[model samples]
Target: MAFGSDRRDPYRAVRLKLFVIQVGALLAIWLVLLSIVYVLMSSELYRVLDSELRRSAIQVIQSYDHNHLSTQNANNQSDFGAAYSLWKITGAASSMSATYIDGTPFIDVRTVYHNALMHPSGYSTTLQINGQPYRIFDALVNLRHGTYLIQVDRSVGPTQVTLSSLISTLIIAGMAALILTLVGGLILTARSMKPLLASWRQQQQFIADASHELRTPFAIIRSNLDVLLHHPDHTIESEMTYLGNAYEEVERTSALLENLLTLARADSNEQILNLSPVSLGELARDVVESTRPLAEWQQKTITLNAPENHCMVIGDPARLRQLLLILIDNALRYSDAGACVAITISCDTTSCELRVQDNGAGIPQNLLPRIFDRFVRADPSRHRAEQGSGLGLAIAKWIIEAHKGQVFVQSKEGRGTTFTVIFPS
Candidate 1:
């Protein structure tokens, strides 16, 4: 019963594995989203920067052509945060000159201008000059004066700073999101596993109880056989008792196996029943009559009280008979001589009710809650005379539930017990 100490925690392992998978999936998705966002943001930023550089290059060319290459006008044209240069190219006459916003030549202008002149069509490139980053755009313009290569260079320090900040923010946010995802995944895993853990524990307990029940009868049968084999010279009449004992254990084992199979089928939802309208009054009378002889032999009384009207419900007749027999047998087994067991049937407009009440030493309050569980018996010692496979009430409950009905029991330690079953009309 102490599931924690008896076995390993399989549910915990499964939950941890599931949580890891979930967190891993979430992290993957987050990384992909961040990659896409960073790519789009960086691309847009570079696009805007390149556009400004191209505009500045065009302005410089226009100012030079209009001012007839005047240095003053060129200095005024360098208003944006960009450096520009002009290269004149004629047959066997190539010369380059550059200017900056501060009236001083920008560092590495000659190398950049030559690189731009080599690729006449417009292109963008990045350069590191004096340990500062610059984004350069090159354009070739064919003016009336000559073919001019205009190179525009802009400082990328601000853009780099902004991008770095964005990267840092994204990293911080991603870390936070990952932490939250891990926590949520763990919580969800635990929540989802609660029922599964309970079911697993129940299954473990069921298997343990079944094995224990089976081992008893097998041990008895084996012992009886061993005794008989040891007494080989004894006459058949003398060893009849040993053979009979073995046979009884065999019968008990067989019954236990049959009940286990029935429960297994029921649990699997594979036991198809032939549902039909059955009269509760007639069924109760039949059950009482069938069990009357046994009750009388024990000096106990069996009675059936039913309304005059037919109490009909949809169910399998044979299974219902078996259900009733199980309850009656349980009642008789637990009751003493002169105790009364009654089967009462009544109906309302929407449902039919059957109550099996026994004037017996009732079930303990602690066991009452799980009385219908498989292999649960009122008598823990399971005295031989009243011993059963302990599946009768479980089967009875399953049959009632299969018919979309409800079964409940009321019992006290010293008083009697009552089992009530209700089925839709």
Candidate 2:
């Protein structure tokens, strides 16, 4: 056996893998959501700013007249606290018609005002003008006298602050949600793996039990063969006892293997029952007769009791037969010689019932619950003595469950044991 250092924990590895996958999916969704919200919010803020600029430009255009270029409406506070520059052009040559500002223009921003007069393109732009954020746009207006150019500059400091606050809030909230998801996902993943971990542990125990059961028969067969090998000079008759022992061990091993295969197929869902309406009373009679020879060999009397009317149930006949054989054979193996083993059957309108009872050393209360578990036998020595593989009851339980029936045992120590089976009609 290896120490802890050599052991790699599969549970931790599997849980971590599942956690990573869940977190990655959530992170991707968060990224997409954040990006979409950011783009939409930024566009909306800019859109409001542009609308205000357009409204201001429209007011400046309407107030202008070729004969008397007016700056009254352009310089008003309702014009969105803006600065404007206007020009008039009759032909190729143009003149600075009017310039308006709600307050005194700073010397640094005088150049921006000058550029508006120098070049006026019909578009909107954002720029850092004179250490302040500004949205600038130029508009073209045609008058009765000539064409006019207007430039508008609006400070965007407040809008910029709102956008920055929105971005910060989104970041903070998203981070908090991501952290919560990480912790929650780890916990949930751990909880989800519990059933799988339990199943894995059971599988490990099952393999260990099968290995232990197989080892004994193999060892016995090898020992008997070794004895035969030692006396090769003797006639075949002289070695009959050793050969017989080996053959018996071989047969026991074959039965063990066959039972293991049946269980494996059952676990994998590869076993399909051929279902039909089976008469339980008729099947019981057939099983009792076939099992009678074994009862005779063991010096026990086997009898069947059933209702006059047929005990009908929907089931697979072959599996039903196997189930009966397993219970009766188990009874014969454990019962004292000449003990009475009885098979009884009864049916009502809704369900059919069967019972196998033996007057023998009964099962202890502690072992009753797990009596049908694989590789579980009350006495290993007695099971081996009777060539029992310890898997018969497990297979019997599987067959009955496949037919959607239930099997249970009732026993009292030193009295007897009875296995009861119920099938829905």
Candidate 3:
């Protein structure tokens, strides 16, 4: 079980922790609020009950005083819709106690009368008789005959029923809220981690690809040096070939390092481009002019087609020129000797489009989706003869996007390829 647990995805644990914290916090707050509400409600109910008991006791005393020793008349008086009992007490003994208006005995006569004599001033307490609860108020009264004790009580059954119902409602609502919060917290935690997981995977892939690309140049340089060292007694004339091979590898390594640096800066958001209005038509013409000699040497033709007027876009001129050169270079490298490479510039009301189309061996359909990913090459060759470090298109895409533009490609195997860059006008 421990071995299996160690192999589990760490992010799942992190997500669970986040979900639990959020749900637990919500439940804690709910419980605190419910406790406060219950305390306040119980206090209010008990306060109202105590006030009613005091009022009933006062009314009974007033009636006894007005009737002047007429016990029957005072007992016959209504208790104002409340349950109460009148008791005549002398010393520790009670006699002839009237029952409550509801015909229920408030308490055991002997026990309550004894307690009333002990506490003559007044007091209120709760009692249970015959499985029913009551709030009892006991007080001593001075009448013309002698001192007497009166007890006022109201059944607390109705109040207990209402409080029980309230408790049930709160419990149900709390349970429902807790369930919803748990579900919602889990969903939100998963959603929030999606982008972070994607970025982590992408970074891992980028590191792996970068390491693979660097190994080739290092291996070439090492092999050439080993060959030279094995024949140390030879003269410079004999060693020239091996030395030149080593020099070429070193240059390739340097170029690869520079490309990696560019990508690193771009990834860190430090590649700040100087923006200005650049004429797309003029830039395309200059690139064609510059590459004309190379095209001639390879027995290939280069052409430029543009609008008559200057088509302008906001961009960093140097970076945009680099972007154009990358596409053109790829085209020239892949095309046959007699093929043609075309640079076209067009503009509409909202955007300017620059396309570099080449009649070369186009990219395979499967490789088109990730063509701009660094260290990804269409050809699967490890040899440096025809393939590059595979960072040119990636850098080009980054530069174009930095200027708030987009790069798109349309290619077919064995037909040709066209790379289109669009900039908002």
lDDT of 2 by residue, 197-314 (tens): 7777778878999999889988999998888788889888998998898898898889889999999999889999999889999999988988898889888999899988988998
Error of 1 at 269 (Å): 4.8
Provide the global lDDT of candidate 3 against the true structure: 0.80
TM-score leader: 2
Q: Give the candidates in order of lDDT, highest first.
A: 1, 3, 2
Q: Which candidate is the best by lDDT?
A: 1
Tally clashing residue pairs in candidate 2.
0
169-218: candidate 1 lDDT, tens digit per residue: 89998999899888878777777777888878888988999999988888
- How do the residues 1-425 of candidate 3 rate in per-residue lDDT, one tens digit apiece? 11124343457667667777888887888899888888888778877887888887788777766763244443433355566666655553535443332223445767666676677777778888678898878777777866656777778887888789889989998899889877777677767777876777777888888898888778888998999889889987898888898898888889888998999899889888888899999998888899899889989998999998989998888998999889998898878889999988999989999999998889999899989988888776434756788999999999888988888899987889999999998
Worst 10 residues of 2 by lDDT: 1-10
Better of 1 and 2 by TM-score: 2
Task: List the candidate 2 regions with Cα displacement exceeding 4 Å.
Answer: 1-15, 47-70, 73-125, 135-154, 191-196, 303-312, 342-352, 381-383
lDDT of each: 0.82, 0.79, 0.80
TM-score per model over all chains: 0.72, 0.76, 0.71
